[model samples]
Target: MKEDKRPILVFGATGRQGGAVAEALLKARWPVRAIVRDIAAPKSVALRQAGAELVEGSFADLDTFRAGMDSAHGVFSVLPANLSETEEVRIGCGIADLAAESGVAHLVYSSGASSGDTPTGIARFDAKPRIEAHIRWLPVTATIIRPMIFMDMLINPAFGLSEGRYTFFLRPDQSMQLIAVEDIGKFVAAIFADGIRFSGRTIKIASDTVTGRQLGEIFSEAAGRPVIYSRFADEVLAANSDLGQLAAILDNGPLADHVDLAAMREINPEIISFRAWLATQRHQAFDALIGSDRTSHSA
Candidate 1:
């Protein structure tokens, strides 16, 4: 089969989500052009080594972004969450506008789980909706993907996994959708490969739904011990208003994953469940954070 040499301009290719998309696109035989702050940076160098064309740039510089879009077939846009909400909105909207102006055939924006039709009352949640609305008005073929909570986040030591307990937003009985970080790339690649199906669509994506109690059970299995799972305590939420707001959103229902898993599987057959992701990433020593007794398993 012949490769599609027309380049897809990918923003933030040195980061997790963009890196996954770059890998997936390369595997699918599509050409990738990555925009990075430093072409000499190790991750950027790796992308170049892996057959991606790299453009050195920062999100703050619109001209650098435009350089990446030159003669591009498509654009994959995702702004890092660390930016101020206002800055995030500006960059996201600017990228969409540029994609339209550059005549890029398709633009896929990686939005957040909390963004939807109504205001989420959280600036971080609200930013993407603003960007999405701007994209809608533009003369561009754009698909908005609102990804669910990342499964990779669950193993972080800050979430209490290192203490043999995991605390999160949902109640033990309340279920939430989760997706592997790699799956986002798989879905994006498929959307790019399909000439028409995904244009002008706003999609919610997730791989599996698991209640908090089920999460406890899964962690117990992985760790070979009873790794307790519970919703963050009332006091914990009270002390951290930002965390509290997120929990409140989940409790109120706007933050829950509503995408159809069956329908999503049709789009990307490679989507893996949370359990599979855990198994595959064990080599990274997430097992240590989750209290997995590797010595016992070896014995």
Candidate 2:
């Protein structure tokens, strides 16, 4: 956005969150250098095609990260959720150290809304707080963004959307903030564009907040059929401890009241809501899931 053309080095560019950031940065005319594992991977190739300077590397490889961050303007850090807490923290913190040591101007770390100083007994959520703490000790100007639950999860067939029923961590009347993956990039781009305003702040972002019942209504309207919505059944939760812990968090945890739609709209005005995401970007996926077995099973 200025006369300087240094790129913002982006990690996890092949995945959902990172890819969104990369695309948004490119659209904003900011140069992006994406660190990827497989240079020939489809997502990696696509990044190159989209004007990203792809650098082959892994998160654990310090040499590769140092090289990529060298002389870069900023760094965007996000680790895979499937990783263990120790590994996630190590890589996340290491990136911050590298960014600061590399003289990067700004660092943006993608953390979960439910993540905070208190442990939620969830590994993925707990790891971020550790990473955040590490960044606090560094000299680099950093913005920690806590993104609410993703709207994309609702479309997963395992969640029962393919069968016209969606089970989640909320009661029909209770509300939870949901963010579109597409919106994550916009928020991140804004944070990078203005370091002075967002640095040293932990801002939570969400495009829309909806109750479970509202989700059903939106899905039904989009699918042209009835879609039931309900909280995770007690039996289901008890059967899976991980899901059970997450559901518990939703009931009473950091996730309950994190999103401020008014503030988010101010930062990224084009924030997409659940209905808009379903009607637009996710329509194909929704159609695929609903049409999966619609003709064979008429439940």
Candidate 3:
């Protein structure tokens, strides 16, 4: 433990990205204060056990955010998108404004890979570019981390991968960038430690780039079984309007653009490749998708 005394306030503490950041901060011996809507939540308790100071607050409450930002050396902010435009934007901007107002030394805002000049016609993915632009003009030194589509999304319950055949947006030939949730924390922590060098920069964070066919091969090899990948059937997409729209964006849009691996490796030396991740993960959660005996579960 490096005994870094300055505390960093982490938003979305209960979720995957925030949880990873909190854990990484603690392991580095840096003081961490995580904002959670419910302190009683299992994830909150886990954060406390991992040495995070938990604060009960939602992104909607600016007072709570201000309090958390005060005396914080850095802030790690992530906003959840559940098809709600208002909450998502408010949360993302509020944290940036609060961090800037409080004079926090370093602020890291987690955005997504799909965010760019051209609109994807998806509100959630596009909202980030607005938030990123807002953060750029803030007074405090800031860094924007645009992570690629999460690898965890593939294992979600909604995709119906448990049926032996996996369906997604890409054709077998299309390549997509993705990142592991665990890698988010490691990369953010490293940035915090080297704040001077990373300040005022926007960087795309992706672990690996793989095609639809490659995913099938990786999954099949990891599971010791056969798993085939195919584009989402038109019928399935037609029936699910929301998924259909998203799949259209993924298939046609720049969401699957590749990242500069050499530069990313320079930032975080331990970035995990998708195949490496599959080999190391022995948990039963992932087994649902590729195991010999499958179960009925979503993601």
TM-score for candidate 2? 0.94
lDDT string, candidate 2, 1-299, tens digits: 67577899999899999999999999999999999999999989989999999888876676788889888999999999899999998888888999989999999999989986679888888999999999989999999999999988878888898877988888999988989999999999999888899989998899998988998988777777898988888998999989988887888888888566888988999998888787778666788988843322111
Q: Rate the local accuracy (lDDT) of all candidates.
A: 0.85, 0.88, 0.81
CA shift at 79, candidate 2, in angstroms? 0.8
lDDT of 3 by residue, 177-261 (tens): 8888888998999999999999998888988889989988777666666777888888888998777877766776657567888
Model 1 CA deviation exceeding 4 Å by range:
1-4, 282-285, 295-299
> Any idea what lDDT model 2 has?
0.88
Q: How accurate is candidate 1 locally (lDDT)?
A: 0.85
The better candidate by TM-score, 1 or 3, is: 1
Residue pairs with clashing backbones, model 3: 156-299, 157-298, 157-299
lDDT of 2 at 129: 92
TM accuracy, model 3: 0.89
Off by over 4 Å in 3: 1-4, 157-160, 233-244, 291-299
| Model 3 CA lDDT for position 157 | 58
Candidate 1 residue lDDT tens string, 62-132: 77788789899999999887887899989999899999999999999999888877776678788988898
The clash number for model 1 is 0
TM-score of each: 0.94, 0.94, 0.89
Please identify which of the two predictions, 1 or 2, would achieve the higher lDDT against the true structure: 2
Instruction: Indicate which candidate wins on lDDT.
Output: 2
